[model samples]
Target: MTVSFGDAGVVDVLDDEDKSDEAKEEVDSRDEEKTEKGVLESELSGEPYIFDYDSFRVEWKVVSHWEGACNVSVSLTNKSDETIHNWNLSFLSEDEIINPYNARITSEGSDGNKWTFKNLEYNQDIRSGESIQFGFQINYGERIDIPFSYSIDSSEKKVSDSDYEISDQIISSWDGGAVGELHIVNNKDTAIEDWTVTVRTDAVFLTVWGGNIKKVSEDTYEFSCPDYCQNIAPGQTAVIGYQLSGHDTSIEILGLKEWGNKDNTISGNSISDNSVSNNTISENSVSNNSVSDNSVSENKPVTYIESDGHQHIFIDSDEYELLEEGIYLLDVYSDSMTGYINYENEDQNDSDNENYNEIKVESVKLEICDVFDETIWEGDILSDDGFETWSAKDTGFVLGANKLIFDVIFSDDTALKEELIIINREASNIKNTFIELTDEDDDNIYDYYEKYFGTDPDKKDTDGDGLEDGVELFLLDTDPTDDDTDDDGIKDGDEDEDGDGLNILKEYELGTSDLSDDCDLDELSDDYEVNVLGTDPTFADTDFDKITDKEEIDLGLDPLNPDSDGDGIIDGDETITREVSKDYNGEAIDKVSVNIGCKGSMENKLFISKASDKSGILHDTAGLIGDFYDIECDADFETADIVFSYDESMLGDTDESDLRLIWYNEETREFVLLEDSVVDTENNTVSYTTTHFSDWGVVDGKAYEEAFDTPNTPGMSGTDNPYMNNDKFKCCDIA
Candidate 1:
């Protein structure tokens, strides 16, 4: 089947053979005819059919058509001042829509004549003066009916300013600035449309957000909701904030008006002509009807000023003394100054002068310059007590000469300038003057220095270390507030000055100098004797062991411990006898001599002693000639030769060559003989080379069988003993 479309609203459906010939003739005949319908006239001329509404306009066009279906393009333009979001366009037509793009068919009439199309996510918002287009195909019986009498609907509900309740609040305030927020609340049952608020203020705006701002006049500003926040739903508030300079200025709400409707407005309160001091705002000053100032204080005394046409600005008086022309002297401690600009205007009510209203001072600035004429500091001065004051808290004046300049500008664009030279005195002169006048503790250290060094001015010795605060800080080069300057647990006054034998306290007590190393004429210094050797500095021999501390240290012995090697013999005695022994019932026995050849420091002294009776190892062996000796050293060593002295009477029937040295292995619970054992007949000692230290004893090699046959040793039972088979004695390896 084939179809043909003509400009005269004619569509003919025919078979394929007659379509080409009949459609050409029908179109040619329709071109010469005219239709009274507006859609038909527009389609014939290939122009769009336009439909106008109060808020938006629509244009419908038929691009192409066939026998039963036609492609149509429609564009929507928002004509109102407010933006339209999530909008729906509805129109009455006799065609059915299909294959829509950039739009969704939301609902259709029962007869399919009325259709409503909603916007897609990407094209939902149609801002003012902006247009969006969409296309779709429509099917008709014989002719396409272009959509007309269209209407655009959105979430926006048009309402007058009376539908909202406006309120202004100061969010925060600082020294010279403040932040304010305006809350526009919708009181109606539906969402409120675009709203604009007119505000009058003398404060300079720094930043604004959540709305659009338009400067209507010098002191009037219009704030309107942006597209995102235009539609304020019921019981919801649209908030906007602005940061502004001038803390003392008042912000007044003049009116609240609807967008695109100038006549529909809610008139606010008249601006207050009264002036308030101390950053106060009057009641009913913002808006009289619904808007209110929620944060400011109420019912303050207002001042009325009679105005003249001209304004005169000048300096009242100079605060600092003038040393020369254009030169003044300012104290180093004076960080701020006042009384530079005149606070009140002089009376100028003269008949010859025109009666003009007085203009207010808009702003004041203070700038400080160095000797080189370069601006060192510049800032705005805030009005306080009717006078403009500036503080130099952040950047203080440099010591020496400086230039101070002030500039005052009035609201009428007239300005006045004043200049003066300021000389800041040197800091040392101020310090000396303060020191001579203030000393609380009478310690000769001034209160000024005490505060500077973080010390207590009322205390002679801050740390109570027996030294004055001044002496500790100046003479001793120590912290005045801390007793232990080096944190070594010693007070400052008790510390040694020159590695001397006497501390400052002792030197003062004895009337001796603290610089001497040995106050008692001893060879040892105080630091070495007391700290290093752990000995008394006043006495020559600390341990009373017949050996001086210096002599003991020179001979590689500990002065604090009389028995340096843990043997029964004293260090002084051991040096002469060349032997160490263990005490048995207060008598020396089991004497031993050790020759350590190692490559490490001996942190602990070498010790040698007979094993106690509580030892679990079996000791009653026939081959053992002497008590088992426990020898140890808390040091790392590769090898050492230990000689164990044995009584000759205990050898009974055993030859000197038959003597052998053996060691008990703790891990294996076995006693093994040393292969490199030497018997010294002259010294009656049995010696052996050992790489490590453990229990050792002298034994007769000829009675090795009797020693190995002994049983019931700890960790040695039955076949568990390594020497149970009675093989040749083997050397035990000790690590």
Candidate 2:
């Protein structure tokens, strides 16, 4: 309908219909439409409908009304409460049709509140005193979800009463590629379901092919519109086209759950797999569901920064799921929020972190307040023109988030709060999974597992010793993955036993001190590591029970001790055993002790001097004893010699008063007194000297061999061999 307004800016509410003066004669000629007579007391005595044009607000108080064939008419109640002034007539558009409209009606009131309608719905009779009251109404451009209530009286009306609303649009979503039709409700409240519908959405590439939304059961639904269905009579809402794709960035989530598969389609009849989703772990991220889904992920956008006028940015990691903790680099985005924030690093040594053992992150510099344990290691912060890092001395470091307030100088002295998350790795957990195990051709661990288990693990045999995979993995404190388990920049496999890597014999540091392997990294191969390196394999150093890497090279000293010196001499100058066993009550029992004799040495001299042993210098007080018999003669004496032989039966003396035998327990490194036993003879030397023995004396290298039966003893044996009876030379020939 084309709306045309008069000079008064008031448009005829009838839309395109027309009227004329000769229209009166035209109405009279139409006598087929009857009318009632007799001084028709037609009334219209009420205020006009008023509204604030500026704000579009209205106020009203009910006054009077009249009933029509197809609509209701009312007269507004004026404030005076005397007469029915303003009037209006309302009707539903439910009967709107594409066919022609025939409207003819008239309202004549004396209070200048007169409305003449031509071709509008006409009335049949109006007798005197049977006043017809009507009110005016203005239709705003926009449709509001307004509350409406009305009652009907006994009358023959064409319109039916029903609770319905007027809307120009409808929305819905579908699973399958199912297409639905539209349903239209007629003036009689009868639905006509038929015509097809198409729907679309502004979201990228998203579309629903159906239009009709039907209410089936109390909750369930069956949406189908065909020629037999109630649809598209007139004024029925229908969808044209709809689609939805989505933005790759800015999670335009479409799933019903807060987090789940976005693209999932379940068939109406399918019961085998209705839910299409998968959950992992017990963190409640994803859930196990029917198999039917689709999705895509990518990194989050990066925000750049202007730290010291240098444009740096945080790289996007939105797409990748962050599980474990580590450092990362974020790229820069030109337009980003971080461009104003400040960050920094405070490393004192300023060593080229390119060789950083821990994970790396973007370094920067900024001024911030901190509480430090000054007595401990204090990290020096090194800053350049562009960047710096927040350095953490050997102590603990914490990075608080926006909870910590900071005054940024670069972006003015603004007190800005932001999330600060810098994490430094603690070396206490660093361990060498590799160790020197037994190997044939040195395939690391192949020979070990091959010989016993018939299978080999990926092992790193740091030492060339002939052991298998776990020999070093469990014992040597080596890394299985790296050939040079220590990562001291030395190959564990190629490390020389005498070199810095293998030889704890000369190594100094053995603690998790800034210069030590914090975790006592290795626990394998404590043998050679102790002996060879002179390291305390059990304890890292004397007094310091924690082992270190340097001493791990030694096979003797304990690799895990920080104190090789028991007397508080931690520098290894005087390493003493320090082990105190604690009782169940946590009290210290005098930590038990065991003496292990010095075993292997490059020097072939296995035994030290008797004097040195008796001195009680060796640990656990284990040493040799002094005995002239052990020095000059064999135990089971049978050899004929110039020196006297011993026989308890032929004893010349029985007590200390007469003089007797003296012997020393070599193993105990102490002298033992003999009983009052008799001696056959007192012994000396074949050829005695004043101060010392000959260059080729028994002490030089030779020791008396085991005893045997005598063949001949010059003057004693009666054997016949003449050479065996020669004893006169040294005594007579010398004269």
Candidate 3:
């Protein structure tokens, strides 16, 4: 059949069924068509029909209709393997179409309801196996109906087969080769018992899946679908895939054959002579490959900044200036490192606005070393939001021309490395930089020096004595400028003036006065404070626990922390062990007195729980000894040595294994067992090394009653007991 527009040339659409089956088979053997109308036709057809023109397919549907207005949608597909360019579409309709848009088409001059449309710039080209679509509203006189038929211009002739068609499409491409699929459609009405398709290309097939290989060659291969697809039904398609190697981007479908029809060849071309008109097949454009390099190398972009003055930040840029070689000092605390990137486009106007690529900081590596590569500081710089920070104060720097190398990695797989010479010149200034006088007195010396001695504001020493200042004034209570303010023949430093058995120099070191026997005045003499009690002499109450230090010592309480046990009880109010067996309940039982001695730097500050207060302590109730005692010691003692002295009389034939020490963890609220306890049976004592002291108690609850007996203390009723006062441990001692 021949269809023609008024000025356009005639278009020949052959109706293959009109020809004899033998003649149709001979015509289909010459060329294998690239189009697959079965897929597009099946998508459009509510019913099936014989396909006569396999080159192109079109369908239109009325989306909506009212009294005078109707909406319609159209679809046009290139069933041929060749790309369609500058294509035109025409269709005969009874209704007048209006407001046409979307997939570009020109319908300016219509011919009596015979609407003719031509492709616009954007929709002009349609690649093989692709489709284009457009829609328009039509003003109809009455009811709306589907279009009777549609046609596309076949100005450019493409090779096709009448019996069947085969289309090869490249699915993906890489550096070397590509992977693709070949689609075969059976155009004949009869079932195809078996079929074969030959593909010829510049690249050789490395592997093929989902198809059975009928023949194989260096640059050509023939494959057929598996058993399920051996007998292809009319209008059905069979798909096969293969991976090819080499740089060739062209794929050609040479020939196709079906069962029981020797002369019915889809394409008559032999494998050697079959080649499509040189179409470049690629997954994506070769120029738009997205692979990038991520290796780190020394020869990369870098930046350097000077550290002589107050500036402390170093950053990377395309046009960065290098600093002059010099020895300079830099404040490490003020140092900062930053990195950025510049993205430019030639099409963009040259204004202040800049295009910045989305770049991320992957990692940052830095190293500081002398010329000998002796690493002073080698580590990774902390990175956040594409910036890094590092300081010399944090690394405890050295004082030389240190070589600092910074290596940074960005998300784009690019790296930047910079090396600089940094010299720390003012290392000594760091100590005195934060120090100031803080002198309260008018004297040249600071107040701290005057407090320890009696210095005159006019002269270095009063009384013109040979000895300077405090030896006579504060240390000995004698006038320093005077030869001898004291009428005694001996100088103050030479006399035991305080009569505490310590001479003047020893008293000064001991912070005692020559005139006063007791400086703290807590009824403890200066000698006792320095030698026996080990309490501070300057303050009357060393721990500042309201009660005088002397009273705490007399009560056998720790004079330092008010809440020694950390059970919310002060040591002063905590029950004391006065002759272990002497019970407060007016009951004296057979019990052995055990004296536990502590020997460590923290011995004087350690909290010891007496057996009398153990059973009645509860964590939440007032006037109750908490389950765990708080053992707070001076931080100086990393570990403490404790020895428990008990004889056979105390144990009463109890095995040593029954006696063990356990520690309580306040955070975990559980008791942890201690190991490696040394027992010296001959010395009648057991010792344990305590790395830390919280609440420690001997295991085997029987040890408490077995060694000594006392009446059970009543539980706390939220009322204060005469013996256990919560007021003493309220943490209000200092205030």
Candidate 4:
């Protein structure tokens, strides 16, 4: 049974088992997408940002610098295992910087030196391992200096010298030149400040971008990080490429050096650089010195290079010129057609048919939109597949004679104009009656007067009883053909068979059944089950115990479970007593009653329900140790409640708060606790509420001895002692 309350107090119940299961499964599957959408919305709503513990990497580059201004770009990458919907970057610097205000980036901060950058509506979401880049210009007095530390959200990142790892390998080789990437990694806990790396290689006239380069020695060349990116944070990588000429086919990094920590100067170098000068020379002499090496290789290795601080494949000038762009159609189709049911054979000229609409061939021709919808090209479509495809320029319809003009662009950036003509032979008025055909289940068959009752897609109400077939089959679990599913005197639509005080439609909407009298089988009618006991009508035993529901109540036990005392003993076998107290509140309190009784014994476990209400049984488990029990009464607007009590002496300090009333689930073979356990420390009792009956028990305490005997004459320690704890032992008579 399922119950739901929608807007305008619209309540509904659905009772079909299979349909309920499918609905639950669907909801569970969509939970993740719903959660993601919620998080995305929260981020878009300008929620406060928190520090992320995941990894982040960024590359910064200085494009150009003049007397007092410099242009810089930063490529921020998310290296973590999550998608960042909204992102921010903050840093401290002395230079006056301007974060370019555009449709995709924004900036904020009061002090010019302290700046915070945010993503605009266009490019905010960044997936893992993807990057978002933005650029800005800064004007400083003297030499431009980059910020020391950088932060994303509220998390800070830094770098040091030990964090610097270097790699320089040959990508491709030719007779006298080679091109490769120079990759520098920051692996420390902080950011590197004002850093410089020197590489010793035998490459003459080596040109690398994203950094400034100068010769340091006869065989050594030094590279400085871009002015805007001198501070390299931890985990961030800086990559530069070398277009080498008159050098060896292979590249090597013999030694290196780093200096000038920006954040903490006292920390100095964290690790030794990979490049060191062997034949040292002054900065002035480096311009005049050159290393001599000449080698060539045939095998070409492809590698990556950082162009303007962004990722790109390394390509020489000649190869770059060979790259060309062309125009291609992505998709084309007629949006006016309903499904694929067009063109009739007999009524080809019948324009009077209401189902058929008229269309002109020339008006149906589609226009070709350029890539990215840019105006950079005018192209003619030479040919296309004769069908309405996702990428075709027009829907291929034989609608009389027609001609289309196309302007196309080739790989050489040259445009051409051409004409295309189409001819049609079959000419007639077409009736589109099939447009009303439907295959809602995607089973490839029309449902109107063609499919079976359950499979009919066009008719949801097959029997037309004001109830949809889906509602009857899946939700109500009733007969779609017969108005009265139970074959009772009243129709199913008009009868509340379950007598739960709700009609069948209401029960269907609330996911409750209206087909059985005692849906829970707790000796309670469906109406009383919900209104009086507040229990589930579809559940035989609300607590899922092994004992028959009504038997628990007749045996002076809790019908909601198999165990009542919670001492590992079923409620039917446990002895119970009652004491009336006026402190309890509710209307149903006057109807509450307790009865204890004795019955047949099983393995020395006494069945106490057979005794009268006024009788008592006395027995000892371990010579002097004994157990006591009692019951309290209460009520609510919906349910009648009872709190069973056991003294703490025999229960081994089991407090009322920790007591959990549980019953054995026969189907799953596991103990499941009732969700309505209410502890009353004031009365030293634990109570459970249910609309039905089942043998119940408390599982947390092992105070009560089992019915099995020990090695004595009676054979067991617990079996020898059998007695009832209360005087009022009788068969509970419940109407």
Candidate 5:
């Protein structure tokens, strides 16, 4: 009897002596057993185990099955637009795999249920829409269970050195050591995983973080990702910091490699084999089987031959010529006019060639196309001098990579086609170009602008002022020919044109505009906001107080402190004021006169009372004529005048000349005598002018010092007057 498995879960049985029913019953029993063993009916009927992923896909199938062992075949297909290299396939299975072909086992689980396989050298690269296959024999005791869940990872092609950019920033430096961070960015569309960066430097690393480090050579160190971060996605960046025991050391990135994919796992249930329509199995043969040679051979120099069995006519030995078969970088602005390819036919020595000596060029045509293969420029090249040189100066190439095709016809009716690829970059990449013209000083400024601005084309800085001519004329909008455009003694680089306390050079370093004092327009000068107030000049409100800095300062408030007075009210929501009053012997004088002078409106009332706390008094001999006056108001006052009229009995034995008005300093916790007080002896009044109000009173200067044993200063003890310790205070002899 013969059993065959067909497509769409179809099974055929062949038997003799009319035993078809028994064979069908046996097959049914086998199916029931597989179902009981947790195997899906679709999987037993030759269905491939499909693992779908974003970048690639994997298909696993059982080609032939026997009682105890079966042959399993696997195929990896690239689904993305990029080619995959250095691929690895991993899965979890209970069966034992033996006699594996086409792939090598890299790792296995301790219980022998897990496996990881890597590609052979020849099959390592799988181009887009292409698939590679490998197979192995699976031995199982009970039933064969296919690995439905699997993962396929692929390391991308080794990117060119130009695709990676490294930037170093010095975070801090001391006398014998320096700390810096290296920022590595992937400019290309390829993610890098488990990458290693090598740098050549003289400094010895004292400490490192964000990456693992190893010394490769005497002056070289290699850095790789730690456990935390292991990959840098396309157009993404990674930072590695290190502290080294050296100063002014030259550290450069020697090279970087091993670009890979970190997240390539196929999760959840197994995907259907819809993509395996053409993946059919034979009864006794494996499909798409391939084996890899483990031996490695040294690479030899490639010798390129033309299609006509002749040597190339063009040469690529000169830096000014571009006749190679590889990609080249060209500056569109600086190298467009002078780019040319030199033609020298080394095959001219062939005696069989009849027109060797008279190999005159018939016609040459050039065509330029974009990445989409759309023709952008096409023209004919006129060469009356026998085509010694060819140029595409008038092609008008666009930015990015472009394809160039050259079709030439010789006088002997021989036709040839030459191809080249050019990448058009900006003027800053001029060093990679074949030739640069017009800018004699190489300052990135065209000669036309230099002449128009009256600057020397031979010198980068025409005025010898340490600023580039192009930067002065274009960036800073300053005169390039003169060092000082404003005739200010300071040079343009040193002058603070916007009065922001930052010079032009400093502004350029910080990427700030030198012409705007308040770049953010937050109603505050950039100088005061950045240096004095420690606020962000680029932000309108640093504290988010809903008030501008200038308004807060104009209102006599701290811009940094939202609630200036610690009164639980923001400065923008409330008004602050001060008031002073006069009293005699702890009583408000009925004849007291008060005058307030200030700007703006006042809507709140004022309160005047005798201060109950008299701890601010510093002079013991100076007797208080009246209790300290505590005044409060809600309107900020510019000036206030108060007069206290008292009867002659209030003076007692103390003469009028012995009286002095004093104020308590809240911040310093000391007493300050008002030296500018005016006393009217006949009017029996003492008047004083003040800008702010707090505590005020009159004290006699001719009293005994021993009358008080305790200091009157707040937060002090003993008989020592806090003001007496400071030489700035004079509290005696008012008469």
Candidate 6:
């Protein structure tokens, strides 16, 4: 029931099963790739910068000083270095882009209207290496509050980082000799399941965010020492702190002007920087409930570095790397302590002040323990046999033979680490798969091999082939023929993934088919169809057309009657219809054995007709005398050869009683008794006797040998319990 169309276009395979959403989500990525090829290619050139709604993290400030107007302070930078001075500064409010050009300030549309700020302006040229400030004289405008956040989506080339290939998500961190952390926060509403995250530079070394940061969705994840992250509730924030190693690439902020305040334009916003800074500070609070969508928001109250005076801190003697501005130590020398200056507070330049002494040298740690998965390799330790051990640690951390540690010293807070080292070393090798050896028990075959020497290659291979089953399955490819693939014991576990121990003698076999060379795998194998199940191997009727014996018996149809019309193909689908017509030469076949019917006599014995050419042929054999079989013949066939058994032993008949058996009655269209022609016992009464031609001819004193011209022709029927019928053997010459 299959059809194939080579020239047909793609058609839907309509099935009756209702698939769930997961199946639908498995989109054909191939179709998507084909259709999106052009769109992807177009974006490769030009590289126009685009930002989403949540591009920058913004904080807002609004202050009162110049009467009803507000004073504002802002910090802006172009993250993109390549796109240079092509950036424009547009001051936007909910109403207008308050500039002469009146450019649409944000990434949205504006209604055609005539309203904008004109009071505030800066005519000075701003370039790659300069940053300047301007004043705004505020007047009638008030209440038209500006959105809090501000950002510059710059066009920059990203660099790719060269790191090891990671199969699963892991949480770890690397510090470029800085005092800040590389934190990772999970933001999905639902606890992420089976998710992996990797954050590293795409290409160029992002001085701001460097090294590899990965996290797997485990119950607990660690990035640094004792450095696991906590769940941050909604509206919360997390930071990946790093020293902002001096980044000064001519970034310009064309202009800075306020577009909103209550009224429309900043007609008169001329205020001194000194005055605005003071006024803005007075109205600011650091502990405000956090919310999204707003602009510049304050974190800590406008705090300043203690005005005691700047200390000359020699961070990197060779490289002028600006240690990120979180906090700083006076010296990175080992053992330097930190303290506040009380007596030295009055002398801003007191060189003798002991309060200026603070030192911390950064180092990595290699801690090992099995207390939990987080504490396993949070730092630098190799994973081996489930035991967290060994390390090259990092280069910054000293490579001692025993233990490795991180160097962290803090004054304001306890370092966020239980283990820290201040030096560098090398990376450790993670040995994932191994082999072991055992001895034979000398008794069991499995024990001698699988148990005793399975793990240990030396005990099993006798010759040093360097291969083992467990190792091959876990690490090496399952193809056991080659000792090493590409000369390595570890294989790319794709092919032969099971390592099912396939050998030259007993190779792994197909999951479904029988072990027969000549068989159709799609249908039942020839062995199972014919030899094993005793079914017709040549049958195409899976549902078994009424011709096959099973189906005929089910329908109560006469199977032995091949042509129920006396034609061949016993009710077979192989009709005379051009597809499968078969002709069974006028001879009917009776596959007979013993006929034990529900009648008075077990007289149905194997009887060959004296008019065999008239009785056709029966394909029964020697051992079949003890069983019964459904004989098949064509409705067209009027002559059938049959052999039925009459048990003289069961009837207790001594001198075989004259017997005869009747099969299907052509006249009645149903079965009628035919006295068996043979009997060796005296207990049964039969007319068609087997002893002599005279005995058989005297059936019922009618002499059936001459009764109906003898069985000259064949007959179509199921059972072969033979005897003499009064029908005069119509098959001999029905006309």
Candidate 1 ranges beyond 4 A from true positions: 1-71, 77-92, 96-129, 134-139, 147-162, 247-249, 254-735
Listed per model in order, the count of residue pairs whose N, CA or C atoms clash below 3 Å is 0, 146, 14, 68, 1, 109
Q: lDDT of each model, Cα atoms only? A: 0.58, 0.25, 0.46, 0.41, 0.58, 0.26
Candidate order by lDDT, decreasing, is 5, 1, 3, 4, 6, 2
Residue 75 of model 5 has an lDDT of 74
TM-score of model 4 (CA atoms):
0.20
TM-score of each: 0.27, 0.14, 0.18, 0.20, 0.25, 0.18
Total residue pair clashes for candidate 4: 68
Q: In lDDT terms, how accurate is model 3? A: 0.46
lDDT of 6: 0.26
lDDT of 6 at 1: 11
Candidate 3: segments with Cα more than 4 A from true spot: 1-498, 501-630, 636-638, 701-735
Mind giving the per-residue lDDT tens digits that candidate 2 earns over 1-735?
222212221212222234453653343344324332111113221222222111111122123333311122232112221211112221122111121112222332222222232211111112222222222332222221111111111111112224122222323333211122222234334332222222232122211122212222222222222111113334444332222222111111111100001212222211112211210011111223211111101111112221232212221333212222211222221111122223433321246644433323333333211111011112232223233223221222221100111222222111111222222122121111121244554554434233322224433333333333443343333333334444456554443443334332123223211112222334433444445544444443423433344432343554345443345644344422221111112211111111112212111221112223333222111111111321221112222121212223322222212322223344443322222323223432122111111111111010110001234433435555322334310111110
Candidate order by TM-score, decreasing, is 1, 5, 4, 6, 3, 2
Q: Which is superior by lDDT, 2 or 6?
A: 6
Write the residue-wise lDDT of candidate 1 on 1-735 in tens digits.
Answer: 322333433333334434465666765476437453223322343444444455666656676777777777777888788777667776666567897865788766433355777765445568787777676888876446653355566543345667778788888887446778889888879755566788897554544555656666656788766433555778888876676654244688876654321111111111122112211121212222221121112211112122121122232334467654445566646545554444443322233435325555556777765433346677776455553443333334544445565666654444444455555654432331212447799766667556535568999988888877766554445566667665567886788766665576665444444557774444777766655766777676667665566656755777787777889877655433222345433222246667674332222357887766464443654467757778888655567788877667656788888888777776766677775688888987778767888887777776765446566445668776655664333344332
Error of model 4, residue 578, in angstroms: 66
Please report how far candidate 4 places residue 154 from its true position, in Å.
5.8
lDDT of 5 by residue, 391-474 (tens): 444444444445565666656544455555555545343332222238889776866445434578999998877788878765
Residue 575, model 6: Cα distance from true site in angstroms: 99
* Model 3 lDDT per residue over 68-163, tens place: 775565556677887565566655555567766434344432443445665533344565666665668877553443333445553422223787
